[model samples]
Target: MDKCFYRRGKVSLSGTIVAVGIFMLIAVRGMGQTGNNSVYRLTIAEAIEFSKSQNKWVQTANMEVNAADEDRKDVIRAKLPIVNVNGSYQRFSGLTLFTDGLSHATTGERKPTPNSAALGIDALFNIYGGGRQHALEEEQHLRVNLARLNAQDQSGNIALQTATQYLNLVKLNDLEKFLADQLNRARFRLNNINALYRNQKVTRSDVLRAEVNLSNVELSLEQNENDIAIANQHLDVLLNVPDSVIIIPADSAGMTKPEVSSLLQLTQSAEVSSYTVQKAATSVDVQTAKLRSIRSANLPNVSFYAAYGLNYPNYLFFPPVNQAYSVGFVGLKAQYGISSLYHNKSKIAAGKIRVKEAAMQREAYADNVRLDVRSHYVKYVEALRRIEVNEHSVEQAEVNYRIINNKYLNQLALLTDLLDADNLYQESRFNLIKAQTDALSIYYHIRYASGNL
Candidate 1:
């Protein structure tokens, strides 16, 4: 029996999918196609997967993470040994001079040499640089964490948005069902009034009123269809699909309201892992590294340098005195900046200020997250209450509608009363569905806020 029921549900869902697909094709084709395209459909889960793969925001977020990863690697590489090929050639059309180191050479005459050149491969390894390289590496490491957090945040946001849109579609479907049932009831009343009028038991006004009510129900149905179409288009845009693509959301009625009373706990937990918090924390680390870098600015930078090269004189590609000669020398290089008293002071001051600012912002963020948790918790409870109240109201409205409808059929109730009851019932049903949607949405938001997203 369960299998049969499941099969029936599948058939019903398939029919709905086909209808939406046809509408989508018409919309995309500009009404030129006479409904000849095969229908394609996606469930809420499938749609979310598609969005993650094709959505522009997801792609852009991933790109940012990739770029940060590359940047971090680049910074680390800066601390590694560097190798470069060096070459130089000089030509003197007029004259070049060469002098002995000990005042004179050979003939003791200071004479002009034609030209000279030098070329070599040089390598430099940083032995120490007041921890500048280390500071930069640490900063980049924090940046890598910041990038990952940002990507995670973006992913979570997408999940929330997709859940909201999917729920909205489900709500629309529920609302349409409510309106359909009301329209059916209205048509039934109109038939009764028409029969009464024919038998001279009711006035023409009574029959006309029933007709008007039925027409109004039909108009409401048309309006609802338009709303659903617009909603589907919006979902398609978010998913990066063609606007005409039909999406079929699964039944969401079974879902319960999110437990948001524990929002404070969740928020506290989530804030500890939140992307914004992580980014801020990383900012502090980065700024601290900057301070270290600034403080090290006054310290001497030590490096090991070595070079071996071939020198050519006068662009001849070889030294005039020697051909294919290689020489290598290793030396310790150190640089001290005495002018740092004025030149580096500003940077040190800026680094300190940034570190302090990050600390303050981190504290502010913690407070804001607590407030947000409290606010959303209230919304969550209110939505849950709405669901409960609307649920009961819809039941009462349905019963009232049935009672009024029966009286109208028995010539005991006015047409307006029947119409009013039917409208009330339908409205109650819509509100119930909306409340349910909100309850579920708020729960997920609370979960997201608490860091479970």
Candidate 2:
């Protein structure tokens, strides 16, 4: 009876182990599938938001702005009182005695301790810098503004890029669906031909032809799937997501067309609102401030300084012995670099030239912005027209395919004709998607050029 009980216990334990193993296997498989099929659904706006928050380029630009702020703070700190402290220690082996000056008699040697130490603190405040300090402060302020404008420009560029990628993904999704339908149709045609062959109503050659067509369609479907993968990977990079994650557009209809003003109005707005133009204008101001700072170099610098320190073995007494005492002094100081009077002319001239160069570059950028706005506007209009034409083409292709399919079924049309009509239908649908996506992309491009994005 004990043996019997042992056998039963063993059996039960084995069964439990097997059950647990099965459960673990099932759990792991479920987890793997979930990981493989992770999907993130995002709209265009959400995608742009994600890019702004997560994109490396945008983050770097923000860091630049922070660095510029710190630099500005440094410049301001330079104008405040500066304080420093220092200490020193020294060791001597012996002391030397010197003769008295009036009597010309040698004095006995007085040797002090071998160790000595001293500590001191000093402070200085700029009383004047010939206006150079103010110019430096202004220049640093402009640098901060320039960094901010640069960040704005980077954000706009990132937004436009994200929008474009999002739209491209939408287009790829539409193409995927279309290709799937085409694949299904091809398979159905092959099955129909096989049935006809079994009934001896169609030749074997016809079956072979249908098989070939199906194979071609299958290849095209596979290629379309690869394209989808590539598009998803690009979106992942933009949104700062893992490459394995698939991004799906929640709204496949694409972005709405923004109401744009006239080209002249857009150009005018761009001149004022464009981050590039603003940065360039600030650059000119910065250069002008720099020139003022350079000119200030020729003037005198005035400052007030004070120092307090303790010294060992004061030298006021002859044959001095070791003693400690505090000494202090305060005074106003003025200094000028005489060479600046003769050498600063060339530097000043160069600074002026740089200011002029900056102004010229700003003007050139404005001209380019106007050209860019007009070009994008024209592309947007053309895309709109294409979308209209393709919409009608899709309708016509659908009608033509239906007629061809019916005739083929009635044994009055060839498979080639039916296939051709189907291909045309798919192409028209693809064209429509492309046109819509292009229109939206071009619209964002226009906004980007105008720095409104």
Candidate 3:
């Protein structure tokens, strides 16, 4: 009866422990879900969109474009006709306006206190210029375009960086899993060696060696786990998420070798609209406009103006009695400055030099863009080949590991041989992962270089 009671008590304790564990697990899961609710889940496309819309640098570039647009419109409107309304009212103790033989004057004007108010609109429109207005407008337009392209370039860079961090995190997770497996295998081997040593079937040295290997594997696993945590932190920083939040990435099993596209086509596209080339093209336009403006310094500008007003010596309330007069005139105004030494010669010479510099910059830009496209294309091709080679290597390493492990278990292989095979397997796995990730990154880069990004 006592034995039965003891068994019952032990079973009851086990059940209670399990119940507590289940409750804790449930609570932890609930907390995780709640935390996840506040975190944003991002897809690749979503990341790109967020960079374009919300990244600080990209948003600043966008605002710059907007400001440039406003400035351009202001410049254009400045060249157009503008109107102003004028109104005034005043009271004076004494006022005078000379007329005829006697000076007509208001003296001691105390009747309802004198007041005057008038309202009129006048406009000034640019009739002719040295194309300075056009040059300024063109400059603003180029600036806006450059700002837009700059934003696009920034978006591409951010997206690439985010993707890189995400892939690194994935690789770290895989490394953690690999380390965990190795640790478990080491532990099992250590237990078996211990049993053999106790039975005098294995040498004491073998048991000691197994224990050392187990310790090493444990340390490695711990380090890998720490690496994974650090990788997660980096990913969080890139996404602007809370560092404590968990990010479960989508499946990464589909990594494959990237294929190379036509280099000529990519280069051609880059020549037209790649970020670097586009910026250079915009600069040329800006500089050209500036040069034209400098040349316009020698030309004259003409404007027209008109104004009308009413004056009275007393306050004019509602439709009170008032003296109203209208005046209009049309005239063309022009001004030119003559300089002897440096005005015309230096400005024109400077503009020519600027034009030459812009041309040289354009040439350099074209060459650099072509080189960039070609280089990235080569990298993409090389990564493709590396991926293929690494994939085969991984397969061979896995087979070698299995064979060596079986041989070691059967006493046909030395422990060192097995360890060597294991090392090869791990190295191959790492190379495969690196090659695949690199290929994907290179593909994205190719797109970016080709202006698709």
Candidate 4:
């Protein structure tokens, strides 16, 4: 019975260990799958979304916007009534008292304790500040708006970057496919040439030429793959993803060309819609408000204040010793700095100059935006034209390649001629892909320049 029990316990222990091992294996595999599943299959829109959420620059700009909002709130809160509570404790080495003639004769000596404590609550309400407060409030509001516009501009820039990278990845992917196909064709040709050489139908030099062609095609394929890897790294940086994470572009077909607006229309829209222009305009308003705020310094400020407190050794009209008593008062006050009348002229002039400078800066920025819009619009149009031309070139090259290939097989054309035709066809295809991607990228860029993206 003891042996049987021991044997059963051993069997149970082995079974438990195996079960645990299997569970651990499954858990590890599940973790691996979770990591692998992190790969992103993103379209341009999705990439933009991820960039807005993850890109460090965009996040920094967003923080600036939040800081501006808080500044505005601080300015507004400063305009409201201010309230505070304060307390103090003190212990003096000695207290001094003056004795009247009668008290000096009646009591020859006097002693005092030195401990004291006091607490108070006070409130102040601004009645007027010569419109300085209002001007400051307006200035803060404009600053907040400026910050928001800056963040919007940053977001547009990030979107443009994501779109550009995404488009380039698609182009590289297409190029890689092209190079792969070319490599395969080279391999096939080399095999055929080798067979022909063995059967005495082709010379050894022809086989050597085919082998050299295959090696060059292989080298091109490797270079194309390196380009793809670099492009992927750039995109990964933009998306804030791990460099090892593969990002497969879901929309390999590329973006459609946006409708081309006339230069006049694009420029007109950019003038009003561009974030850069709007930010510059807001800056002008802020500077103007600052000038108004500076001018208000010449006027007197009015306020009302009240306080309630307890004190030891009351020092009011009635004499009380070592007793706590409540005291309260309310009053209105006005203050004017007479020196401001003499000292503020230069400051006001400087403020005015700053305002003028801001306005001029705004005009300059608007002009630049117009030029940018026009430049991108022209590029997009030119790209479209190139795409049309490349399309026909690809067709002709394909036909030429077919004719040359047939001649090569029939021993009527040199291997070099066939290889040249194949290269032309491939080059035409690559040019078409490049032009199409360029047109799409430029279209998005135009929208970004117009502040529409």
Candidate 5:
């Protein structure tokens, strides 16, 4: 009766401890759900979206895209005519109207004309620049495209990173719960071992071993808690949230493998959809446009010139008079750099080589993208297989642990055997958690590689 009463007392104490652990868990979860400053329940989608808006790399890339668009606008303005307005007033001695200062020399007059003022507009529009202007505008357009592609690529990268951290935090949360359960079980086993010790059914070594097992579980819990803290802080940095905010991850979503078309179709899709490939192609276009611009050096340039600007005095007549004059004229101007026809041979050759290099670079990027897609798809398939295997392993380990625990209670199995089974069970569960999270991560990797992330 005494031994039985002692067993009841031990069970009661252990039950209280387990209840307290559970209560703490519930309280923390409740705090997380209440949207308090100290605790927050974060979902995967929310984390990713917030990170994109706040991530430094993503913001910088978008800013670069804006700058490139501004540059494109500046280039477009080149098509507009160069225009200017001028006005001048002069007094005698300073020459109100000076016909190259020849009126004073020829007329023996104090000044060609006393005070005079005039104002007009002058304009020059490029009629032809041997395609240089067209090439320059085209280059700017290509640059804008390049910047946009780069921004897309960077945004996708940041999103992928955010998702990765969110998933990792979810994994750590699962591990924490698992460790808590393990701690409760270890506590129960230790209490039973102590009861057995009271009845002299087990040696002192068994009680010592049970205490060691409980300590190990508690230590494992502590270590897991530390990991969760680190992961939480890292995620906070990613989302740009306040450091004091504690993020509790919500339930991890089941992985839905995206429906992929045939490999042929995916390859074709990547050719147009992949930012890396598109950026490389844009580089090729930029180089080709630059080549065109360089070729223009050897060609003559033509422009339409129209200038209507007045002189201070009426100098066109034989006898100059003080007046505010209005003049209007227009003409065509042509120019050729005779030296460039011979001097640009090396430059033109270099430009052609760069164009070829750009084309080669584009082809290289396309090939890499195809290879990357294939690699990720293979990993995704492997992750699925791992998930199936790990799930079966967990089921087997749980059953084995149950059988071993029963046999030990019946005095048929050794304590070491029970402990080994417990460890196996925990390991299987851990592996299964990682497998599930890894499978989802690999799916996202495939999405990233295909340029759909």
Candidate 6:
């Protein structure tokens, strides 16, 4: 599935690829190089892939995911103990010890070491944080997931955009080809009219009519050529190609008809797979985790601490010693914030509100996702029906054109009648091509709405 989204838009396994291949085989070929520029050819799948890598929104989303992952790692590290090894050397200007403050003989204790060196190691690990650490880790993990979902959503968006633009370019190219065909027919009609007028079989009015028709087709062809050129430049910008490079799609739209069972099925699928819904759901989890973290402040904080130190002229004794001494101790420490009892109350209440808000927001997004999926599916069905309708119209117009062309050749029909038939035929062809492309567009839009694209 080119749509396996780099990660969820997986399409019909091998069948779709083969179908696309066959369709493109019959679709438009390369438009050749634009004047004096490098010709870059692209297919629809290739265009979508380019959009994922080159589109700024997708790039930004990917960056967010990376940052979120790093954050999650940081949160995990927060649970680990902090260890420090510290050392210092010092020469004292004067040493003073006050033994007479607690006993007699102050002068004897005052004869202390003039220099000292000390080293210490300490480790502190949280024994308890009212479960705040775990909650924080959970929130960070969910945020990382949320970021990933956002990235998937962005990838789907860019892919859909690229596909839509690519299809538009293809539709215009198809029209240009059709119009060129009509232009040829117009010239042939005009030449035949001139021959008939020279033989005095048709009036000059008829010849003038044919010439006017030929000019009209010429003007239309010119307009389409210009549009195609503009489409080329737009595509270059869309693909994020260098200004010096032009991307001409080697495409002939051959989108396989999307197989959908029902709107209910799609809605259900979206609930399970949709990135928008998933992101919203993750948001709820994030908020819930945050609330838990906030509530954790209600419990007393506790930690285990261990420290070992060596120092000259030990100060732990009543009389200061000149020799070095070492001490090590390990114990648990506990603390409770008296202010948090009151301060945390409002914060927890607000946190609870936010959790509810987040849940409601998830529901809202899920609702919109379902609606979007349903609407697109309906449009897809309509587009498919239109393609059917336009196809029959094309058949009828083709027959009508043939009949009128024959009648005009037999001198049994006016030039105006034949020109009308030609116009109808062209219009019908244009409509069919348009319907085909529209159906494909709607199909992808449906996928995008469900976060599958």
Which of the numbered candidates is closest to the native, going by highest TM-score?
Answer: 4
Candidate RMSDs in Å, in order, are: 8.4, 13.9, 14.0, 13.5, 12.5, 6.0
Give candidate 5's whole-model lDDT: 0.76
TM per model? 0.81, 0.83, 0.78, 0.84, 0.83, 0.82
Question: For model 3, how does the per-residue alpha-carbon lDDT over 29-77 read when each residue is reduced to its tens digit?
Answer: 5457556443334344434433334445555666777888898888888
lDDT of 6 by residue, 29-104 (tens): 4323333336657777777766666666776787898899999999899889999999999776653455658564
lDDT of all the models against the reference?
A: 0.71, 0.79, 0.68, 0.79, 0.76, 0.79
Report the C-alpha displacement of residue 128, candidate 2, in angstroms. 1.2
State how far residue 289 of model 6 sits from its true place (Å): 0.2
lDDT-superior candidate, 4 or 5: 4
Give the Å error, residue 326, model 6: 1.9
C-alpha displacement of 221 in model 6, angstroms?
Answer: 2.6
Error of 2 at 447 (Å): 1.8
- What are the runs in model 5 whose C-alpha is more than 4 Å off? 1-32, 35-38, 89-110, 113-118, 253-268, 317-324
**Residue runs of model 6 more than 4 Å from their true location after superposition:** 1-43, 53-56, 94-111, 114-116, 199-212, 233-251, 260-264, 406-416
Question: lDDT by residue for model 4 over 146-214, one digit each (tens)?
Answer: 887887788778878988999899998998899988988888888888888898988999999898988
Question: lDDT value for candidate 1?
Answer: 0.71
TM-score of model number 2: 0.83
Cα lDDT, model 6, residue 83: 98
Model 4 residue pairs with clashes: none
| Candidate 2 residue-pair clash tally | 0
Steric clashes per prediction: 2, 0, 4, 0, 0, 4
Candidate 5, number of clashes: 0
Residue 396 in candidate 4, Cα distance off native in Å: 0.2
